[model samples]
Target: MTHSKRYQHRTIISFFTVLIVFILMAGGVQAGIEPSKVICRVETDRAILPAGDSQNVVLKITLDAPPSPAHIKRPLVNLALVLDQSGSMSGTKIQQAKAAAIEAAIEALTRLGLQDIFSVVVYDTNVHTIVPAQRAGNIQSIINTIQQIRAGGSTALFGGVSQGASEIRKKLESDYVHRIILLSDGLANVGPRMPEDLGRLGAALIKENISVTTVGVGTDYNEDLMTRLAQKSDGNTYFVESGFDLPRIFAAELGDVLNVVAKKVKVTITLSDNVEAINIIGREGRIRENQIEFYMNQLYGDQEKYALVEVNIPKSTSGSRIKIAQVDVTYENPFSRKPEKSTGISYASFSSDSGKVARSTNIEVIREYQLNLNALAQEKAIELSDQGKKKE
Candidate 1:
């Protein structure tokens, strides 16, 4: 071959190599950019309720983000697991619950690599601190302790919660997600105070910034009291039909709770007169001293999540009437706010009718169900008291 041809071939090869290197670098840069931020927005397009009438409305918001990345720092969790070891929770219920609690604790330890502090309280006629508030370093010991809980006596739901909350309060200085996980299968029957009085205690805990998540096991349990406790504390309430379903729910939910990226999430709503009533569902939005705060109970990864608010508007006349319900969500973010990645939601409604209007959501339904449960429990308490008097 000619020398000139050889030189030209070498030059061509060098240029191609440089081009390939550039392409590879570009690809790596693209791959290195973190995934898009996740955001959840829940709203209702139309909520119509009769004038001077009340109805329950449900607004279901779908969470569409991908699973959180594996390497992100999981939030610090100071958890108190309040288990109900009442006589009703014998056999399968107690066994399944213990297993599930173990699974959840292990998963949190392994997956998140979190410095978790946990307390286990099992209550029947009285509350027993199986594992006092302590850092969860030894997983096997915690699991073993949980497995040792056996069912006995009456239900002291209030005592269990109060004790659990007290334990959580000790860890308030850690800035961790302080929470009480209450599991119960029956109404309170042995506590010194009435179940309704527990609401006052729960509200006080909320003020102390301690949240409660209540889980109702089986159909006969008093879901009302459990739900109320959760709502008042700005936490979550769950229903488990059987023992077999306990582990998965506990693992998924406890992990999510521990993974909370933000705390003290506040949402404010300014409604126009055209909207008669508005209900914030799923999670209770509390009216604080000056501002409104929604205790965000779930973990969000790389994205913003939303709560559903349903508004009832008066029926429209010939002309359109516009009304705005501004929603402001404020949360603590560990990362600096990126203007390009801000998350929020704007919801509005309109009506021309002079009559009254009402609205509801899934949260509302749950809240009502909770109320009904409370009434039933109260009635049962009264009946039992009367029966005791008659026996005496």
Candidate 2:
């Protein structure tokens, strides 16, 4: 069997006549918006699919660019620093976490030229408010509060996150980029201890325009739970093998937050007739009958975020023009402090000519698909290895 038959189950021949229209509608303020700030480009792996047979097509949608320097100014931020003070985090782990919270996380916000808000919460069986949501102007005061955090008792991971979310809610602003940075080293031992509970908490926070980024220091933390929290909130997750790397990870995350140009970023994808919407690869999203909806907490300056949709293309005859997908993005522009929308439409024409389908293949989309395939293979290998070890 040929490679195409082994992978796709059948050979697909098609050509793409994609027409993507990216319209920025901000109530006529679109003219003032820079084109480079945010961009949406879509690509399909192959332009043509096998007629009369459903074939899989990958839709790669990329949102590119960081905010410009001028636009980066005055992008207000509301941040919550949630630290785990569980007994396992005692010693160098907790100390470095505190250093990261102050020297990296807090300092990065101050450099942004915005009077950003900051709150600190520490948990060890009980949640403690080190600092309530307030202006980041009092640098020394924030540092002093962080210095007082001492690791002890069992982990109350969920409680700490809940408290952090509560503080952010108090000062939630549509213009401010709201985020929670959680540092943990152990499993939750008290108050809503399951990963699902934390995932729900993260999801709820996102609805209120807040995202939660998780940093797991040392090897004792539950990666699944931490990662799930970040996924639900559309936030970043970092695994630090050593305590010293915590500060660097925190700095990188804060830098992204400081460079945010848009908040509450959502992408709505509507599939055309005869096309079925599948799951979004590597992202938290919902696929309805024919529509897909997913969101990112914010779009940072100089960053590229993308969504991959595995769509099923129904069989069609040659010379047929099919509407593949329509993408609409809605986001709160930090510069304008108003909601902005961008829409793009993709259409493909069916072609039975093998040469045209082969020539029309997008190299970028093919590369992405191959990369994901490699990742899935690696995951399978790891799973098999673990199973073997269990059997041994």
Candidate 3:
């Protein structure tokens, strides 16, 4: 909901007064190195639950930023720039967007790791691959091609993204963090154009570990479609009211690219025997027979990523402890060039004291749960509006 503090990360203080944090200590991480340990925490909405009938509870699994990456070589980035060269971006909008894109690409290319790859795809009524995915060695040629381009056709937003993702898939290796930065100045006029279309495409792309950051340039662009794609793909989305801020947005996106510390992060929450998970709040999560899972393409340094799962908890005897869930996290640590794993379990005790149950309420988790509920309401409203049932 806010971008002002996008880069300002908060320190993680695991479940305060009313919660418990358990770190999963494993046997095989490189010994002696402090950063080798996974900075993950598992907690519940309360340290204690009521000793009566079934209760629905929230389970939170947090992955604190791993250690600072100053000591290790940064990971490779496989990036694609998808530019909308539609008829609407005729004047300053097109000019400024091109200038900003070229500037950002050149700057990133100058210092990219040997394994990093780059590509550029421009789209109008039809999608075109202006620059195929390749190492950053031909700077002048790339600039020349960008400068000679002109804008005049309708927007094929879907095709543009599809082509961009296809290019990145060329070198989709575990060593590289794949991303597509799409900038647009018009609504989709050709091909699949609805926000739902882009959302479905984004969801599919993320399965391959590729994220598409969408930048809506000027007031004419469709914010709904842009944000839908980004949200579905687990990428950042920006709405720039003016073309003047295109360069700034592009640079900020690059900054995030460099801050990546881990990639292909898979977090699985296995519910205990009796607990039944209702759903994952806030973001997309896969629910299995007895497990809930979430995935992250990459994690930034000191950035906190977490998941909230709503579960149906069975009643337990007063003073008895009942297991809730266990967390298992697996990610590729680019610095160590190896896969890593972390695990932890959470248990809640039953209390007959009404006051004790009330006092054990986790404020933070409750706040997150409220936000998730609000998001769900908004989503329902949008769907209703889309169905032409606004009055209902």
Clashes of 3: 0
The CA lDDT of each predicted structure is 0.55, 0.70, 0.74
Candidate 1 weakest ten by summed lDDT: 22-31
Give every collision pair in model 3.
none
> What's the lDDT of the predicted structure labeled candidate 2?
0.70
Mind giving the per-residue lDDT tens digits that candidate 1 earns over 1-392?
Answer: 34433332232222222211221121001112233333545444333233333323333232333344444444466778787777666433333344444444444334443256777777889889887877645555555555555556898888888899878877877666777878777768886445467667778887776888877877878765777677678777789776556666565555456445555554555554555444544445654323333545344564445454455554544233343344454554422222212233434333334342233233543454455457658868977866747431
Per-residue error at 60 for model 1, in Å?
10
For candidate 3, lDDT tens digit of each residue in 1-392?
12211111000000000000000010112223335446778877888898988898888788887654555556667788887767665544333343444454445445444446777788999999888887755555665666555666799999999999989999986577788988787899899999899999999999998999988867888888999999889899998875556656756776677677788889999888889989888878899999888989888887888888889989788999988888999988877768988887889899999899999998888887888889989988877877954431
TM per candidate comes to 0.61, 0.81, 0.82
Colliding pairs, model 2: 14-48, 66-301, 66-302, 67-301
Candidate number that wins on TM-score, 1 or 2:
2
> Weakest 10 consecutive residues, lDDT, candidate 3?
11-20
Candidate 3's C-alpha runs over 4 A off are: 1-34, 91-115, 384-392
Ranking under lDDT, best-scoring first? 3, 2, 1
Tens-digit lDDT string for candidate 2 (1-392): 33322221110000000000000000111225443446777778876654556678899888875554552244666778787766666533333333333444334333444256777788888999877877645455455555555556899999999999989988874467888988787888899977799899988988998899998877888887898899888889999875556556655776677677777788999999888986577666889888898788788877778878899888878888788999988887777677888777777777878888888888888887778778668768866866747431
